[model samples]
Target: MIKALIIDDEPLARDIIKSYLKDNIDLKVLAECSNGFEGVKAINDLKPDLVFLDIQMPKINGFEMLEMIDEPPHIIFSTAFDNFALKAFEANAADYLLKPYSKERFLEALEKATQKINSNAPIATQKIIKDHQESVEILDRIVVRFGNKIHIIGLETIRYIQAQDDYVDIYTHEGKYLKQITMKYLEAHLPTDKFVRTHRSFIVNIEFIDKIEVYDKESYVLHLKEGQKISVSRSGYSRLKEVLSF
Candidate 1:
C-alpha cells in the first residue's frame, strides 16, 4: 500500500481529504496532522511516501517546515492561495491542489504523484528550495542547516564570503558558517552597494573595510576593520572604486 499523510490546520479540510482518499484503496491514509510541527514529526516517524500539505499553518509555514526536513516526501500541496502555485511547482511538488477543489481534481493529482513514485524519479526539492529563495526578494537574512541545528544569519553581520569549491564560507563576528551556495548567486542577490566582490574568490562587506592599499600600479589589497587583509583583483579594484567613489 502507498502510505500517505495529510497535513492541514483545518479539521474540515482534513476530513475532506480523508473522504476523497477513501475510494483510492491503493493509497492508505497513514496519519493526519494539524500543523507543520506535528507534520514534521509524523513524517519522520511514519516515513510516509506522500504528503498532502497545506501552506499556511501555526508556528512554521509549509516552506519553512520543508526546509527542516532532511529528505522530504513527495508533496501534493493543498492551499487556498493561488499565489503559491508557482513556488509550489518550483519546489518540484507533485501537484498543487487549490482548496475547495473537486474529488476529480484530487484524483488527477494523486495519479500524477503515483506515477512519479512508481518510476522512482528523484524529486529535486533542494534545488527548488534554492531557486524559490532567490525568487522572493533581496534577502535580509539567510537560513542555513549546520549539522543538526539551523542558523539564521543576518546579511549585515556577514564580514565576507569566500568560495570553497561548490560551497561558500560565510565569515561573521561569531565565526564562519559553511553554506552550500554559489558565489554567482550571492553576487547577484546580496546588496551590491554593501557587499563588493573584491576578488574572483572573495566578496567583502564595504562597511567593514578599513582601507585599500595598492599592491602595485594596478593591483591592490583591502585591509578590513577586523585586521584581515583580502586580495583585490585589478577589475575588483575598479568596481570597488566605482562604488566607494574614490
Candidate 2:
C-alpha cells in the first residue's frame, strides 16, 4: 500500500480529499495536517510515500515545508491558487490539482504520483527551489530549519548573511541560522535598498551598520550595531557607496 498524507489548512478541503480516497484501497491515508508546521512534523515522523500538499498555509507555505525536507516524497500539489501552477510543475511535482477539482482530476494526479513512486524516480526539488528563489522579485522573509526547529526570519531582523561553502549563514537578532542557499541567489532576491553585498562572503543589512572604517589600503570593514565587524571588498565598497550615497 502507498502511504499518503494530506496537508491543508481548511478542514473542508481535508475532508474532501479523504472522501475521494475512500475507494482507493491501495493508498492509505497516514495523517492529516492542518498547517505546514504540523505537515512538516507528520512528514518527518510518518515518512509518507505521497503527499497531497496545499500551497497557502499558516506558519509556512507548501514550498517552504518542502525545503525543510532532505528527500521529499512524490508530491501532488492541491491548492486554490492558480499562480503557483507553473512553479509546481517546474519543481517536478507529480501534478497540480486546483481546488474545487473533480474526483477524476484527483485520481489522475494520484495515478501520476503512484507511478513515479513505484518507479523510484528522483526529485529535482532543489534546482526548482533555486530557480524559484531567483525568480522572486524581492524576499520579505526567509524560512530556515535547524534540527527539528524551524525559524522564520524577517528582513528587518537580519543583521547579515555569510557564505559557508554550499550554504549561507543568516544572522538575525535572535541567533544565527544555516540554510542551504547561495549568496548569489540572496544577493539578487534581497531588497537592494536595505541589503548590500559587502564582500564575496558577506551581505550586510544597512540598518544594522554602526560605522565603516578602512581595513587596509584597498579594503574596508563595517561595524554592526551588535558589535560584529564585517569585511568589505573593493567592489563591495563601491556598491555600499552607491547605496549609502557617500
Candidate 3:
C-alpha cells in the first residue's frame, strides 16, 4: 500500500481528500494535519510515501515546509486554487487537486503517483520530475484532439518541436504531429532540464539527442540520436550546450 498524508489548513479539504481515498485500495491515508507546523511533525514521524499539501497556510508555507525535510515524500498539492499550476509543476509535485475536486481527479493523482513509485527506473526520474515540475509554465499531459475525439499526449514524448505558422509541430520517436498551441506557450511549460531551444523555431529534447555538429561559421546542428537533424542558431546553440552540459 502507498502510505499517505494530507496537510491542508482547511478541515473540509482534508476530510474531502481522505474521503476520496476511501475506495482506493492502494493508498493508506496515514494522517491529516490542519497546519504546516503539525504537518512537519506528522510527515517526519510517519515518513509517509506521499503527501497532499496546500500552498498557503498560516506560519510556514508549503514550499517552506518542503525545504525542511530530507527526501521529502512525493507531494500532491491539494487546494481550491488553480493559479499555481506553473510553480507547482516546477517543484516536481506529483499532482494537484483543485478545491471541490472530484473523486476521479483524486484517483488520477493517486495512480500517477503509484506509477512513478513502482517504475523499474531509478528514483532519479522522480527528482528530475520534481525539479522540472517547479519550472513548468503549463501543466504537462494535456488533452488534445487526435482525430475525432481527445487523447492525452504526454509532453515528455515530444523529442523535438518546431512552430509552424500558428501551430506547433511536435516530433517524437514514434512520430510527429501538429498541435494548436503556440510554441511560445510550449516553451514556458516545458521542463528546462528536459528540453532546450536549438533554433528560433525549434526545441529539442536533450535526452533524445545523439550529437551536436558544428556548422560552417554561423551555427551548430543537433543530430538527435533518433537520426533527425535540427538546426541550432548561434545563441540558441550556446544555450543548448549549457543546459544539456554538452
Candidate ranking under lDDT, highest first, comes to: 2, 1, 3
Worst 10 residues of 2 by lDDT: 85-94
Top-lDDT candidate index: 2
Name the TM-score of candidate 1.
0.77
Q: Please, what is the whole-model Cα lDDT of each candidate in the order they appear?
A: 0.83, 0.87, 0.72
Candidate 2 per-residue lDDT, tens place, 33-102, comes to: 9988888899999999988888888878888888888878878887787454466465554478877999
> C-alpha displacement of 193 in model 3, angstroms?
32
lDDT of 2: 0.87
Q: What digit string (tens of lDDT, one per residue) describes model 1 on residues 106-144?
A: 999999889888899887555655656667556567656
What is the Cα-based TM-score of model 3? 0.48
Encode model 3's per-residue lDDT on 119-233: one tens digit a residue.
7323332453345344545555543434433334576787899889977778765566666666666677777788888887998888888988888799888898768889999
Displacement of residue 15 (Cα, Å) in model 2 is: 0.8
Q: What residue pairs are clashing in model 3?
A: 80-99, 89-133, 89-134, 90-133, 90-134, 90-135, 91-133, 91-134, 92-130, 210-225
TM-score ranking from best candidate downward: 2, 1, 3
Measured on C-alpha atoms, candidate 3 has an lDDT of: 0.72
